[model samples]
Target: MDCLFCKIAEKEIPSDLIHEDEFVVAFKDINPQAPVHFLIVPKIHIKSLDQISKEDNALISHIFNLIPKLANELGIENGYRVVNNCGPDGGQTVDHIHFHVLGKREMLWPPG
Candidate 1:
Protein backbone atom coordinates (compact mmCIF):
# COMPACT_ATOMS: atom_id res chain seq x y z
CA MET A 1 0.00 0.00 0.00
CA ASP A 2 1.03 3.60 -0.58
CA CYS A 3 -0.05 4.86 2.81
CA LEU A 4 2.81 6.56 4.61
CA PHE A 5 1.93 5.11 8.00
CA CYS A 6 1.65 1.71 6.40
CA LYS A 7 5.14 2.07 5.04
CA ILE A 8 6.37 3.08 8.43
CA ALA A 9 4.61 0.17 10.12
CA GLU A 10 5.92 -2.25 7.53
CA LYS A 11 9.45 -0.91 8.02
CA GLU A 12 9.37 0.07 4.36
CA ILE A 13 10.09 3.59 5.54
CA PRO A 14 11.96 4.68 8.63
CA SER A 15 10.51 6.67 11.51
CA ASP A 16 11.71 7.40 15.02
CA LEU A 17 9.69 4.52 16.33
CA ILE A 18 9.09 4.39 20.09
CA HIS A 19 6.87 1.35 20.26
CA GLU A 20 5.56 -1.48 18.16
CA ASP A 21 3.53 -4.60 18.76
CA GLU A 22 1.35 -6.93 16.76
CA PHE A 23 -1.62 -4.51 16.87
CA VAL A 24 -0.02 -1.10 16.62
CA VAL A 25 3.01 1.03 15.76
CA ALA A 26 4.09 4.27 17.35
CA PHE A 27 6.71 6.89 16.60
CA LYS A 28 7.71 10.45 17.24
CA ASP A 29 5.74 13.02 15.33
CA ILE A 30 7.72 14.65 12.55
CA ASN A 31 6.11 17.99 13.32
CA PRO A 32 5.75 17.98 17.06
CA GLN A 33 3.34 20.39 18.74
CA ALA A 34 4.84 19.90 22.21
CA PRO A 35 8.04 18.75 23.88
CA VAL A 36 6.58 15.29 23.78
CA HIS A 37 4.60 14.47 20.66
CA PHE A 38 4.12 11.10 19.08
CA LEU A 39 1.60 9.09 17.13
CA ILE A 40 -0.04 5.73 17.62
CA VAL A 41 -1.17 4.07 14.42
CA PRO A 42 -2.76 0.71 13.87
CA LYS A 43 -0.80 -1.64 11.65
CA ILE A 44 -3.97 -2.61 9.89
CA HIS A 45 -5.16 -0.02 7.40
CA ILE A 46 -8.33 1.71 8.50
CA LYS A 47 -9.16 4.73 6.37
CA SER A 48 -10.40 6.90 9.20
CA LEU A 49 -12.27 6.90 12.50
CA ASP A 50 -15.49 6.92 10.52
CA GLN A 51 -14.50 3.64 8.97
CA ILE A 52 -13.99 1.49 12.00
CA SER A 53 -16.20 -1.55 12.23
CA LYS A 54 -17.41 -3.63 15.16
CA GLU A 55 -14.72 -6.10 14.24
CA ASP A 56 -12.21 -3.39 15.07
CA ASN A 57 -13.39 -3.23 18.67
CA ALA A 58 -10.54 -5.27 20.04
CA LEU A 59 -7.98 -3.32 18.06
CA ILE A 60 -9.37 0.00 19.20
CA SER A 61 -9.56 -1.22 22.76
CA HIS A 62 -5.97 -2.35 22.59
CA ILE A 63 -4.86 1.03 21.32
CA PHE A 64 -6.55 2.83 24.20
CA ASN A 65 -5.16 0.30 26.67
CA LEU A 66 -1.64 0.93 25.43
CA ILE A 67 -1.73 4.74 25.37
CA PRO A 68 -1.06 5.57 29.02
CA LYS A 69 2.01 3.36 29.26
CA LEU A 70 3.35 4.95 26.10
CA ALA A 71 2.55 8.44 27.32
CA ASN A 72 4.44 7.73 30.54
CA GLU A 73 7.37 6.24 28.68
CA LEU A 74 7.49 9.32 26.47
CA GLY A 75 7.90 11.35 29.68
CA ILE A 76 4.48 12.90 29.84
CA GLU A 77 3.39 11.28 33.11
CA ASN A 78 2.20 14.63 34.43
CA GLY A 79 -0.37 14.95 31.66
CA TYR A 80 -0.95 14.42 27.99
CA ARG A 81 -3.44 14.89 25.16
CA VAL A 82 -4.74 12.25 22.86
CA VAL A 83 -6.39 13.39 19.63
CA ASN A 84 -8.04 11.52 16.82
CA ASN A 85 -9.31 13.67 14.00
CA CYS A 86 -12.10 12.04 12.08
CA GLY A 87 -12.37 13.93 8.82
CA PRO A 88 -11.30 17.02 6.89
CA ASP A 89 -13.25 19.34 9.14
CA GLY A 90 -11.57 17.67 12.11
CA GLY A 91 -8.02 18.28 10.75
CA GLN A 92 -7.20 14.80 9.68
CA THR A 93 -4.44 15.12 7.12
CA VAL A 94 -3.53 11.56 6.29
CA ASP A 95 -6.09 9.05 5.13
CA HIS A 96 -5.00 6.37 7.55
CA ILE A 97 -6.23 6.64 11.13
CA HIS A 98 -3.83 7.79 13.86
CA PHE A 99 -3.92 9.14 17.37
CA HIS A 100 -1.69 12.01 18.37
CA VAL A 101 -0.20 11.95 21.85
CA LEU A 102 1.28 15.22 23.03
CA GLY A 103 2.34 16.70 26.35
CA LYS A 104 5.13 18.18 28.48
CA ARG A 105 3.42 21.54 28.12
CA GLU A 106 0.28 23.02 29.52
CA MET A 107 -2.46 22.20 27.08
CA LEU A 108 -4.82 24.99 26.28
CA TRP A 109 -8.60 24.71 26.17
CA PRO A 110 -10.52 25.29 22.91
CA PRO A 111 -7.59 23.58 21.18
CA GLY A 112 -7.58 24.76 17.59
Candidate 2:
Protein backbone atom coordinates (compact mmCIF):
# COMPACT_ATOMS: atom_id res chain seq x y z
CA MET A 1 0.00 0.00 0.00
CA ASP A 2 3.04 2.28 0.48
CA CYS A 3 4.18 2.24 -3.11
CA LEU A 4 5.18 5.26 -5.17
CA PHE A 5 3.88 4.01 -8.51
CA CYS A 6 0.60 3.03 -6.87
CA LYS A 7 0.27 6.56 -5.49
CA ILE A 8 0.98 8.03 -8.90
CA ALA A 9 -1.55 5.73 -10.54
CA GLU A 10 -4.13 6.69 -7.93
CA LYS A 11 -3.48 10.42 -8.48
CA GLU A 12 -2.37 10.82 -4.89
CA ILE A 13 0.94 12.10 -6.24
CA PRO A 14 1.01 14.39 -9.26
CA SER A 15 2.79 13.14 -12.37
CA ASP A 16 3.04 14.44 -15.92
CA LEU A 17 0.81 11.69 -17.19
CA ILE A 18 0.91 11.35 -20.96
CA HIS A 19 -1.37 8.35 -21.20
CA GLU A 20 -3.78 6.54 -18.93
CA ASP A 21 -6.69 4.14 -18.97
CA GLU A 22 -8.43 1.88 -16.45
CA PHE A 23 -5.42 -0.41 -16.07
CA VAL A 24 -2.21 1.50 -16.77
CA VAL A 25 -0.56 4.91 -16.67
CA ALA A 26 2.31 6.48 -18.60
CA PHE A 27 4.28 9.45 -17.39
CA LYS A 28 7.64 11.18 -17.51
CA ASP A 29 10.38 9.94 -15.20
CA ILE A 30 11.30 12.34 -12.42
CA ASN A 31 14.99 11.66 -13.01
CA PRO A 32 15.37 11.23 -16.72
CA GLN A 33 18.27 9.24 -18.18
CA ALA A 34 17.64 10.53 -21.68
CA PRO A 35 16.08 13.45 -23.52
CA VAL A 36 12.99 11.32 -23.94
CA HIS A 37 12.38 9.15 -20.93
CA PHE A 38 9.14 7.99 -19.39
CA LEU A 39 7.68 5.13 -17.40
CA ILE A 40 4.76 2.81 -18.17
CA VAL A 41 3.23 1.31 -15.04
CA PRO A 42 0.24 -0.82 -14.17
CA LYS A 43 -2.52 0.82 -12.15
CA ILE A 44 -2.52 -2.25 -9.95
CA HIS A 45 0.50 -2.49 -7.66
CA ILE A 46 2.57 -5.22 -9.22
CA LYS A 47 5.86 -5.60 -7.36
CA SER A 48 7.91 -6.83 -10.28
CA LEU A 49 7.73 -8.71 -13.57
CA ASP A 50 8.74 -11.94 -11.88
CA GLN A 51 5.73 -11.57 -9.66
CA ILE A 52 3.25 -11.58 -12.50
CA SER A 53 0.91 -14.56 -12.62
CA LYS A 54 -0.96 -16.27 -15.44
CA GLU A 55 -4.00 -14.27 -14.44
CA ASP A 56 -2.00 -11.13 -15.18
CA ASN A 57 -1.12 -12.24 -18.71
CA ALA A 58 -3.87 -10.18 -20.28
CA LEU A 59 -2.86 -7.09 -18.38
CA ILE A 60 0.75 -7.60 -19.36
CA SER A 61 -0.17 -7.95 -22.99
CA HIS A 62 -2.28 -4.84 -22.78
CA ILE A 63 0.67 -2.95 -21.36
CA PHE A 64 2.95 -4.11 -24.17
CA ASN A 65 0.28 -3.36 -26.78
CA LEU A 66 0.28 0.28 -25.74
CA ILE A 67 4.07 0.75 -25.97
CA PRO A 68 4.31 1.47 -29.70
CA LYS A 69 1.46 3.94 -29.62
CA LEU A 70 3.03 5.59 -26.60
CA ALA A 71 6.40 5.84 -28.33
CA ASN A 72 4.81 7.56 -31.29
CA GLU A 73 2.92 9.91 -29.01
CA LEU A 74 6.26 10.82 -27.43
CA GLY A 75 7.74 11.36 -30.90
CA ILE A 76 10.17 8.45 -30.72
CA GLU A 77 9.01 6.83 -33.95
CA ASN A 78 12.58 6.50 -35.20
CA GLY A 79 13.53 4.15 -32.33
CA TYR A 80 13.43 3.65 -28.61
CA ARG A 81 14.56 1.42 -25.73
CA VAL A 82 12.26 -0.44 -23.39
CA VAL A 83 13.80 -1.61 -20.15
CA ASN A 84 12.38 -3.36 -17.12
CA ASN A 85 14.76 -3.81 -14.25
CA CYS A 86 13.66 -6.83 -12.23
CA GLY A 87 15.50 -6.73 -8.95
CA PRO A 88 18.20 -5.09 -6.86
CA ASP A 89 20.92 -6.77 -8.88
CA GLY A 90 19.12 -5.60 -11.97
CA GLY A 91 19.32 -1.96 -10.82
CA GLN A 92 15.68 -1.64 -9.92
CA THR A 93 15.41 1.33 -7.61
CA VAL A 94 11.66 1.29 -7.53
CA ASP A 95 9.86 -1.76 -6.18
CA HIS A 96 7.17 -1.74 -8.85
CA ILE A 97 6.56 -3.29 -12.23
CA HIS A 98 7.31 -0.61 -14.83
CA PHE A 99 8.97 -0.15 -18.18
CA HIS A 100 11.36 2.61 -19.06
CA VAL A 101 10.84 4.11 -22.51
CA LEU A 102 13.99 5.91 -23.56
CA GLY A 103 14.75 7.62 -26.87
CA LYS A 104 15.96 10.78 -28.66
CA ARG A 105 19.51 9.41 -28.62
CA GLU A 106 21.28 6.23 -29.58
CA MET A 107 21.35 3.87 -26.61
CA LEU A 108 24.33 1.60 -26.23
CA TRP A 109 23.93 -2.05 -25.37
CA PRO A 110 25.40 -3.88 -22.30
CA PRO A 111 24.38 -0.55 -20.77
CA GLY A 112 27.19 0.96 -18.72
In angstroms, the error of model 2 at 63 is 0.9
TM-score of each: 0.96, 0.96
Query: Going through the candidates in order, what is the number of backbone clashes in each?
Result: 0, 0
lDDT of 2 by residue, 19-45 (tens): 999999999999999899999999998
- Residue 101 in candidate 2 has what lDDT? 92
Residue 101's lDDT within candidate 1 is 92
All candidates: CA RMSD (Å)? 0.8, 0.8
lDDT of 1 by residue, 1-112 (tens): 7899999999999999999999999999999999999999999999999999999999999999999999887778688899999999999999999999999999999896
lDDT of each model, Cα atoms only? Answer: 0.94, 0.92
Off by over 4 Å in 1: none
Candidate 1, residue 108: Cα displacement in angstroms equals 0.7
Instruction: Record all residue pairs in model 2 with backbone atoms less than 3 Å apart, i.e. clashing.
Output: none
